[model samples]
Structure formats: structure tokens, C-alpha cells
Target: MKIDLFITCLNDALFPRTGVAMTRLLRRLGHEVRFNDAQTCCGQMHFNTGYQKEALGLIRKFVADFRDAEAVVAPSGSCVAFVRDLYPKAAEWAGDEELLREVRLIGERTWELSEFLIKVLGVEDVGASYPHRVTYHPTCHAARLLRVGDAPLRLLRNVRGLHLVELPAGDQCCGFGGTFSVKNPETSTAMLADKVHNVLSTGAEVCTAGDNSCLMHIGGGLARLQSGTGVVHLAEILASVETVNPAAVVEPARFSAEGLA
Candidate 1:
């Protein structure tokens, strides 16, 4: 199957390695992965920030970008949630029936990375190895919105030499609701502090999540507190192949986009 990679705005700018890792993992599973530089934000920020009218253009662009793909996959759960849950609303608000039809079609084909890996592809183990104690933070969209229950954990459990621990309050928000973090700094910081405390309590060396936005928020707090805990995306862990090259798994910066064609 040919898959289109929708590297969300934050991943493109702040966490390019996540996209690169996702592409590597998809190809490793014997699927052709295609990257369209034309793709941009899924209008999630605009929709969440009450800029629905302004988000219509982006929604249309997103629909147009991956319309022909057999399946559209994204590493970010929140962005995928936006397309699945809000694109139709945006089209309705614009009173564009044609756009609404396109939105429904595109949204049905979009999948969160874990959802696609476990459900669509029917594979729990991607043959990964990460020898470190780690805990997972179920991002809001992945947990509540996307309802990706146990899919990520099942994959993690299959990784060789990886010690997976349950995070306290694993379902709680990491306080990184995109604009929510910016608009309500104090509340966001307070929530983040509680999350950081829980993460530290896990005694895990690394904290992993499906979304970088949550990881960045949780990671910043961990860094400020001088904690030894590091943050990694789930895709990076799954993309690791000891035989192919251990460096790519240990250091995401070593990930090359050469195979992302």
C-alpha cells in the first residue's frame, strides 16, 4: 500500500526526527511511504483556538494534499484527531457540500501512527529494541479523542529489552493543548508540574508519548527540574532495529531522510 506521510507543523519544525523515524518504520514494514512537501498544519491550531473560518483554507489544502493516498498517516494524534473530528464541521460552517464530502473522504483515510500500525496493518511487533526503563504518557487526543486504547502499549510490550512501566495518572492531560498552553500559562504550568512529578515517580529514564507537543511540555519541566529523564516519541522506539544500526535508535538526529522518497 502507498501511504502519505503528513508531518504536522510542530514535527516539521521542532521534531523533524519523529517524521523521519515514522517514515523509516513504515518502509521497514514493506510499505511504500510518500512525503508531500505541500502538506502543512491540519488546521488543528486554528480550530482549537476558535479560528474556524481561518482554518477552512488549511482544511481544504490538507484534503487536497492527501486525497489520492491509499491511507494518510501522521505521527501526531491531535492533528489526526482534528482531521477526523473537525474537518466536517469546518466544511459545514463554510456551507460547502463538496468540501464536506472531500473532508469525510480524507478524514476516513487518516490514521494516527499507532492506530495504523496495530489496526490497519495488524502488526503489534515492528521488531524494535530499546534497553531502557521507560514510561508512556497517553496524549489527550490519543487517549480520549482517538481512543487508541492499549495499541501503543501493546507495541511497546513487544520491543526487545525494553522495560515498560505504567505511568501514574497515565491518562491525564500533559497540559499542552497547543494554544491552551500559551493562553493559560499558569494553569498549564501547574498541570505540567503535576505531570512531571508523576513522571519522576515512575523512576523511568525515558518518557515516551505519541505526540511531541505533550513531550515538549513534559520534557521542558523535566529539564528545568534537572531530572535525568529524557523524552522520545513512540515511533522512534518502534523504528529502532539493532541489526540495521543502533545509532539511529539511540540518537534520532542520526536518522536520515534519504529513504523518505
Candidate 2:
């Protein structure tokens, strides 16, 4: 099966290595992957931040990028959730009927990384091998918006020498609501502190999630408190194999900002 990666704007501009990692994971599993360079923002930031006009163009850009592909996959759940769950609303709000029609069609085909792995790919064990005690923080976008529902957990359970620790309040958000951290730092910090506390309680060396945004938030809290735990994207884990150590797969240096840029 040939898959087209959306490589969301964030990943394209900042974490491009994630796109590389994602493609490699698919190829390692014996599938063809293509990175359609035409892809851009999914209109998520604009739509979520109430910039309807800016979002419309991005919506169309996303549609054109993967309209002909077998499946459109993205590493960030927030972007997929925005394209899948929020695009039509943003399109309709733009009062452009034709655009809204196109948006609806695109929404039907997009999948969050985990969803694509478990549902479209029909396999959990991506032949990935990561030796570490890992726990997952279910991001609000992937967990609530996409309703990913244990797809990630089930996949992690099958890995070799991998101890999957259940994070306390696995359903809780890590308090990284895009611009929420900036608008309300105190509340964000408080919630993130609690999230870090929960992550550390597991004694896992790394805390991971489907959405890099949440892991960034929780990971920062861990780092600030000098908790020694770190954050990693789920795609990195799924893409890991025995020869390729997933735990050592660090996000590129350019993506070191913890999701603010």
C-alpha cells in the first residue's frame, strides 16, 4: 500500500525528521511511503486561533496535497483532528460553500499516526524494538478529538523487552492546548506540573504521546523540575526496530523549543 504523508506544517518546518522516521517505519513494515512536498498546514493553528480566513487557504493546500493518495497520515493528532474534526466548521464559517464541500471530502481520508498504524495498516507490532519502561500520555486531540482509544497502548504492549507502564490518569491532557500555555501560563504550569508528577510517579525513563505538543509540555515540566525523565514522539517508538534503538531516537535539534515556536 502506498501512503502519502501530510507531514504537517509543524513537522515540515521544525521536526522534519519525524517525517523521515515515519516513512522509514512504513518502509520497514514493507509498505511504500511518499512525502508529498506540496503539503502544508492543516489550517489547525489558524482555525483553532480564530483566523478563519487564513485557515481556508491552508485547508485547500492540505486537500490538494493528498487528494489522490491511498491514505493521508500525520504524526500530530492535533493537526489530524483539526483537519478531520474541525475543518468543515472552519470552512463553513468562512461562508464558502464550495470550499466547505471540498473540506468535508478531505476530512474523511485523513488519519492520525496511531489510527493509520492500527486501522489502515492492520498491524500493531511495526517490528519496532525499544528497550525501556515507557508510559504514554494520551493527548487531548488524539484521545478526545480523534478518539484513538487504546490503539497506541495496544501497540506498545506488543513490543519486545518493552515494559508498558500505565500512566496515572492516562486520559488527562498535558495542558498544551496550542496557545493555551501562552494565554494562561499559571494554569498551564500548574496542570503541567501535575502531569509531570504523574509521569515521574511511573518511574519510567521516558514519557511519550501521540501528539508531540503534549509531550513537549509534559517533558518541559519534567526537565524544569530536573526529574530526569524525557519526552519522545510516538512515531519514533513505532518506527523503532532492534537494530534501530527507538529510545535513542531524539527529535532533531531544531525542534528543541518544546512546541512554542
Candidate 3:
């Protein structure tokens, strides 16, 4: 199956390797993936902050970017969720009839990576290998908005030598609400503290999550105080193998696969 890749703005700037790993994993599963130069932000931040007008411009850009693809795939649940759920609302708020139609049309085409893999491809095993004991953190976007269910676990369970560990209260939000983190640092850190504690208690080497935003926050807090468990994007884990470690796929430790336990 042919699919267009939406390397979200966050992933593009912070964790480009996660995007690359996504492509590698998809291709290894025998899917033809395409990337568009015009692809840009899904404008999740602007919409969430009540900047509906500004977000409308992004909605139009997102639609224009991926509207013609056979299918659209993004390694980000947050961005994909915004595109799928909020774009039309933004359009409506702007009182643009044509924009609403366009937003809805594009939103229908966007899919979070895991959702596209399990729902559209119907395959759990992508024939990837990884030797590690890892826990999966169900990000708010992928869990609640995308409601990807056990698609990630279903796929991770099939990886060779990959031990899936349970993260206590793993489904709880990591408190990284994008702009919410910056605006409410103390609150964000307080919330992230619980998430890190849960991760540490898991005894797993690494915690993998769908949203890079959450992982970034979780990983940063875990690193600042030197928490043992590290954070990694789910796409990285899915794309990882013994020979090609997702750890090496990243660098500089900012978005790097460090503390990926």
C-alpha cells in the first residue's frame, strides 16, 4: 500500500530519526511511503491555545499538503489527532464553509502511525527485531483521541527478543500538554514527576510512547534528576533491531534515544 508521510513539525525539528525509523519500519513491512516537501505543522498548538484563526491557516496548509495522498501517516498521535479532530472545528469557528469541507476531507486522510499500521495494514508483526525489556506509554493523543487500543502492544509483543513490561498506571497522561508545559512549568513538572516515578517503578530499561511531545517532557524530567529509565518514541522501538539500534538512530540527547533504558 502507498502512503504519504507527514513528518510532523516537532518530529522534524526535534526527533527526525523517529520519522526515519517510521519510514524504515513501514518499508520493512512492505509499504511504499512518500514524503511531501510542502508538508508542515498540523497546527495543533495554535488550535489548543484558542488561536482558531491562526490554526485555520495551518488547517488549510495541512489539507493542501496531504489532501491528494492515497493515505496519510504521521508518527505523531498529537498532530494526527489535531488534524483529525480539531481542524474542522477551527474551520467552523472561522466561518469558512469551504474551509470546513476541506479540513474534513484532509482530516479523514490523516492517521496516527500505529492506527494506520494496525487498522489499515492489519498486520501486527513488521518483521523487526529488538533485544530489550521495554514498556509502552500510551500517550494522551494516541490513547484517548486516536484510541489506538492495543495495536501498539499487539505489534510490540511480536518483536523478537522484545520483553514487554507493564508500566504502573501506564495509561495515565504524562502531563505534557504541549504549550501547557511551557505556560505551567511548576504544574507540568509536578505532573511529570508522577510519570517519571511510574516509569522508574516499572523496572524496565526504557519507556516508549507514541507522542514525541510527551516523551520529550518525560525524558527531560527523567534526565534532569537522573532517573534510571529513559524515554523513547514508539516508532523508534518498532523500527529497532539488534543490528540497527534506535539508540544509534538518534543523537545529541535532546531528542536522542538516550535513557531509552
Alpha carbon lDDT of each predicted model: 0.87, 0.77, 0.80
TM-score of each: 0.94, 0.91, 0.92
Q: In model 2, where is the ten-residue run with the lowest total lDDT?
A: 252-261
Predicted structure 1, TM vs. truth: 0.94
Candidate 3: segments with Cα more than 4 A from true spot: 243-249, 252-261
Model 3 weakest lDDT span, ten residues long: 252-261
lDDT of 1: 0.87
Residue 73, model 3: lDDT of: 88
For candidate 3, give the lDDT: 0.80
Ten-residue region with minimum lDDT total, candidate 1:
246-255
| Count of clashes in candidate 3 | 3
Following a full C-alpha superposition, what root-mean-square deviation does model 1 have from the true structure? 2.8
| Deviation (Å) of 131 in candidate 3 | 0.9
CA lDDT, candidate 3, residue 84 = 77
**Which of 2 and 3 is the better model by TM-score?**
3
